[model samples]
Target: MSTSTMNPETADRSRRALAAEQAASLAATNDWAHVDKDRVHRDWHELYGEIAAAITAGAQPRDEAVQELVDRHYAIASRFYAPSRDAYLGMALLYAEDDAMRDWHNSYHPDMVEFLGAAMMRYAETRL
Candidate 1:
């Protein structure tokens, strides 16, 4: 078996790329009216728990794990029905102010805010 060591920079870039891809996928999907919000929230909590456990188990690095969490969070949020562009934008704006969002942004080595914002803007454009 061969093992490779990833430098911090490469790992950071990979995590950001993953987040971007996830955001784009979420944006591209057209259906949302049938999503169950409560179920999504519960799933998010479960995913977060899994990530935390993975971190504790050394299965993944914290940065990568947190990026996954953010990706899942956005994917779930993207499934919600927003009646108008204003409503969608309002949710994004509210996300910007959310404590968990801020914590995720702070935890990443790269500029997660910029990356996530770009993805979110693309999501908005797809809706328009």
Candidate 2:
């Protein structure tokens, strides 16, 4: 549950694995065209970790700091496809409900999937 104390090597491995997995998933969905897989992986790797840390620090979904992070997340996602408010909220639902996606997010923090889903939904409601 405490990601702050997660070993650097292990974290690096996790990030690399998630990045590759995400890139492959995007490619499979035909959404990787013109998308820099490496960059996408890197950005997501950093962003996910940062969001995990913020959540661990007790930032709520509607908190300013958490919202800022979600902004970055939205921007990164927009590179692949523009999302309407409903679509973004739907993504939050997918992250929380999809076993694979939930497992992937929980790899960073036990509460990652729930926290991220809430944050994304809040972002969609307020900003998207």
Q: Put down candidate 1 lDDT per residue, 1-128, tens digits, no spaces.
A: 00023244543454454455445555765434367868987886676565545445544223454555545655666565332333333344433556787566435423344344433434444543
Model 2 has how many clashing residue pairs?
A: 0
Q: Per-model C-alpha lDDT, please?
A: 0.47, 0.74
In model 1, the worst 10-residue window by lDDT is 1-10
Candidate achieving the largest lDDT: 2
Local error of candidate 2 at residue 60 (angstroms): 0.9
- Pick out the ten consecutive residues of candidate 2 with the lowest summed lDDT: 1-10
Cα-based lDDT at residue 52, candidate 2: 86
Q: What lDDT does candidate 1 reach at residue 92?
A: 41
- Relative to the true structure, candidate 2 reaches a TM of 0.74
lDDT of candidate 1 at residue 87, scale 0 to 100: 38
Query: Clashes per prediction?
Result: 0, 0
Q: Candidate 2: which stretches are off by over 4 Å?
A: 1-30
